[model samples]
Target: MLPFTYALRNLFRDPARLLQTVGGAALVVLLLIAAVALNEGMNSVLENSGSTKNVILMGKGSEESIERSEVPLSAESAVATSVRGLQEVLGVSAVSGEIFYQAPLHIAQGKESQALLRGVLENALLVHRSVQLIDGRFPQSGEVMVGHLAHRKLGVAEEDLAVGESLYFGDTELKIAGRFIAPGTVLESEVWFDRNDLAVLTQRDSLSSVTVRMDAAEFEDVEVFTLQRNDLELAAISEQGYYDKLSTFYEPIKVMTWVTAALVAAGALFGGLNTLYAAFAARIREMATLQSIGFTRKALFVSLIQESLLATLTGTLVAFILGYFILDGLAVPFSIGTFTLTLTPSVIGVGLITGVLLGTIGTLPPAIRCLAPSLPSALRSS
Candidate 1:
């Protein structure tokens, strides 16, 4: 058996070739990792937005996004009184009526941009713990709470977002009372206000949807009742399932990722194969000399494989560190939406496995082809 050092030294013999082959492989691995992480991060953003005990009540045909749905505000009292197993706090059932709208917000003095508007009661915040105020106080009626991302986009500092500062949206002058954060979720792109205030502002006394906090036992009853109700055209679904539907919102992104990864891997695999074939072909005489001196073909193949594995593994390690520290945390800007790329444990595992697999698959054929020559021919050629 050859020493591992012998195989490694051969790979480093031509620094330029080593760099090119490893770099290409690393680039492929990085691209794959980025795509996987993006999917997971987006999934996480949606998945983490809801709790298992919470149920969303939307118009019968509506899915997760309430912006596209409409439900009468009176539906709240009906669900509270009708749905059995519904818990209560302070005399109110574990249900909250809410409204969601998209409003044009003028953050810049002379420019206007659009932002999602969410209107819910104080009790709604208690039910959805994801809404955390990082600064100031919660917004009162005629006031608004901007999300952390919204604040950054608007270039509004905590001090600048005073309780009395006016935010002009449509004909309403909304007061800035607080700043809240729901990290990694779509909520970060919204401004929140009181439900009643929003109803007056938007001129829609009706709500977009209703959210209910029910026990595990209540989910079935609530779902069945909401669906079967003759008076109201409403449906109930798990909040998690609702957001999972948003994955379609990211369909183009997911497709683009898969296509880009396939192309990159294909290019990298071919480049790696070419580099390995050339390197092994040049060493035919050397391999033959070793064979004549008692080195087995199996041993030569193993040595070449080890060299390929080492290079790929090195590149994978470097790429992982770079992707996590530099690329993953970056906030990618887009016209439709923006999110930070994240690298989780699953992504790292995939990248490493891909690198090792690329190494084994790319170099095996070339190594075997070079080793096909007889020992005598190799020695004579040498």
Candidate 2:
């Protein structure tokens, strides 16, 4: 058996090969961490965006996109009165009739970008219990409030959307009255306006959707209301159900991301294997000499694995360091809103597992081929 120091010392014999092995493993592990983090972040944000206690009432056949759904302005009051057992805060019904729109918003000194707009009355805070005002106050008529992460979606400097700043919605200039945050939810990437103000700006009288918070009531109760009131032409879906549907809607994108990571990982795997092949082939004669002195082939194989693991583990550590600084808490903007990428425990576990696989599996083909030669054939010629 070879001493552990023997394997460790051999790694420095060829600096370039060691670097290649380390870099390849780092790239593969980084990609795995990023891909998993991306999918998880997106899914987490979408899941958190909805609550079990809430139901969305929208126009039938428009459940896929709330922006396309329109409910009569009367439905807001009607649901508050009709849906018994709905949540109540200070005697006010926990109902929010909102107008959802996505349009280019112009910042004074920044570029125009498409931003999610949600028009809601003050009662929206009651329904969306996650929302908390971090600065200033709720928006009033002719004013708006920006979410803490809205600047990421708006493609502007954070100061551009700061309280006291103004944004242009088409030809109308709206003041930034405040900033709020809904942690882990897509709502943090939206701009909220007074319902009447947005209706006037978009020139629509109908509400996009009406959201209600349930207490003693259940989803079936909300569904029954929609079914019983055929005149409203509305559909009822639990908020959680709605976002779950949305997650599937973006499934193809996630699949594409996975495919891309797989391809890159495949490339890195082959590249690392090639590096190991070259590095190990040069040591065949040394291995043969060791065997002649009674070092078993199995022992030499274990030594090679140890060396490979050292390089790969080193690379894994580097990847995690870089990911922590670059990927963690990073805001990533998507169609609905921006989600934050984080280095959760699950992401770290994925990275460590990937590194181990690369160290073990990726080393097998090259290691076996290097040690496969007959003893006499290998010893005679160099």
Candidate 3:
């Protein structure tokens, strides 16, 4: 068997080729990381947005979109009185009638971007355990609380979303009263305001949804209530289940991201293959000489693989470092909300596995072809 050191040393024989191979592999790995990160971040946001202990009561036909749903204002009271095992906070049932609106928000004198706005009552905090006021105070009339990633979604600077700053929602100018965070959830990209204030601005007389906190065991009661109340046209769904549906709805987009990455990586693979072929061809005579010295073909093949793996692994390391510094925790905005790309354990595992596969698969054909000829022919030719 060839010593591992022999394989390692051979990589540096032509520094230019080594760099090119490593650089190509690094680019491919980086692209794969980005693709995986995008999908992971988006999925994480949607999956974390919901809580199993909470239930959302939306209009029956608009189960897919809370923004389009319209539940009667009286449904909140109905759900509280009718449902059993609902959580309570300070003698008040943990129920919040919310209004959701999507509108263009003016963040500066001339800048505007589309944003998701949620209108919440005080009890909203009790039910939304993921949310926490990190700065200033909760919103009041003519005031709005921005999410941590709201500025990113709004295409504005962080300073523009600070407390005391003002933004325009339609013709209404609202002050930024606070900043809140709902970590790992899509709520981190929304603007929250008083329900009545939003109702007035959007001229929405009806609530979008009523969210209630209850035990999982009591979900059937809420569901039964929804089914019994034919006049209300209400539907009950677990908050977690609602977000799961959203994730499923966006699955195609995530798949397309992977497809795009695969296409680009295929191009890189082919480019790397061509470079390896040339490099191996140049070393045919050297390999034949080693064969004459009693080195088995399998041993030579293993050494070539080790060399390829080393270069690709180096590239993978560079990709990981770049992803951590440049991509991780970076906020990306989409139609619904913004999500921060994270270099999670699973994503890192995928990147590492992809690198190993590239190294093994890209080197095999080239190495085999270089060793195909008889020893005497290889020695005579090159």
Candidate 4:
């Protein structure tokens, strides 16, 4: 059997080829890391956005989209009084009637972009435990509060969303009274206004949804209330269940991410294979000589695989460093809100496994072809 050093030394025989192989493999691993990070970050945002103790009551057919759901303005009071076992916060029933809207918000005199708007009463803070006022005070009528990432989503400078600055809604200007944060959730990318102000601006006569916080064991009571109130035409869903459904709805996008990674990785795989083929073909005589000296064909094949793995593993290290420094914690905006790309341990594990597969699978065909001929034939050919 050949010494392992033989495989290691062979990799440096052609510096340019070694660099190319490593670079190509690194790029492929990086693409895979990006894809996996995207999936992880998106799922994390949606999963953390909900709580087991909360329930959402939305229009019957609009369970999937709270923004499209509508309940009567009277339902808020009715549900608070009718629903039993709701958690109380600061002497108020933890029930919030919310209105969701998306429209072009004027950032400047002429520039405007779409932004998510939420209308809620003071009880919103009680119902959504994740929300915290980071600056100034909660919004009042004719004023609005901006989320931490609202400026980024609106394509405006962060300074433009400062506490004293103002944003336009339709023909009316609303002051930015405060800034709030809801880390790891989509709420960080929205603008909040007084429910009455939003209803007047959008001419919306009904509420978007009713959110309530209650004991998990008492969810049946809430469900039964929704069932009995045929007049409201509302459906009840646990907050966690709602977000889980949202995650499922976005499954195809994650699948598409994998598909895109596969396509790009396939291209890089061929390029790496071509490099390996050339590198190995140049070492054919050396391999034949080794075989003649009693190094078994099996040993030679193993050495070839070892050389490929070394190059690919180096590339994998570079990919991890790049992912940690550049991609991790990078905020990516979506229609609902923004999520930060996370380089979690699981994502890194996927990248490492992908690197191993690339090294092993990529070397098989080229290694097999290079050793196909007899030792004498291989030595005599070149």
The candidate maximizing TM-score is: 2
In terms of lDDT, the poorest run of 10 residues in model 1 is: 330-339
Where does model 1 exceed 4 Å of error?
Answer: 109-112, 151-167, 170-173, 224-229, 248-252, 331-340, 379-382
* lDDT at position 26, candidate 2: 90
Point out the higher-scoring one by lDDT: 2 or 4: 2
Ranking by lDDT: 2, 3, 4, 1
Ordered from best to worst TM-score, the candidate numbers read: 2, 3, 4, 1
lDDT per residue, candidate 3, 1-382, as tens digits? 9999999999999999899989888989999999989998898888888998989999988999999999999998998888878888778989999999999998756689999999998899989988999999999999999999998998888988999999998777899999999998888899998999999988999999999999544888889999889889999899999999999999899999989999998998899999999999998999999999999999999999999999999999999999999999899999889998999898899899989988998899999999999999999984
Q: 116-202, model 1: which lDDT tens digit per residue? A: 788988777756767798777887888888776674445455344445566887767778888777777767757788888988888
Model 2 worst lDDT window (10 residues): 373-382
Local accuracy of candidate 2 as per-residue lDDT tens digits, 1-382? 7999998998899898889888888999999999999999999999999999999999999999999998999999999999899999889999999999999998988579999999999999999999999999999998999999999998888988889999999878999999999999999999999999999989999999999999999989889999889999999999999999999999999999889999999999998887888888888898899999999999999999999999999999999999999999999999999999999999999999999988898889999988999998778757
User: What's each prediction's TM-score?
Assistant: 0.87, 0.99, 0.97, 0.95
Cα RMSD of all models vs. native, in order, equals 3.1, 0.8, 1.4, 1.6
Q: Identify the runs in model 4 with alpha carbons over 4 angstroms from their true place.
A: none
Say which prediction, candidate 1 or candidate 2, comes out ahead on TM-score.
Answer: 2
Q: Clashing pairs in model 3?
A: none
> Number of clashing pairs, model 1?
0
Kindly list the per-residue Cα lDDT of model 4 for residues 1-382, writing each as its tens digit. 6789988998898899889888988999999999989998999999999988999999999999998999998889888999877888667899999999999888655669899999998999988999999998999999999999887788777888999888898789899999999989999999999999999999999999999999533788888899889999989999999999999988999999999998998998898888889877877888898899888889999999998899999999999999889998888888888899988888889889988988898899989988988988999968
lDDT of 3: 0.91
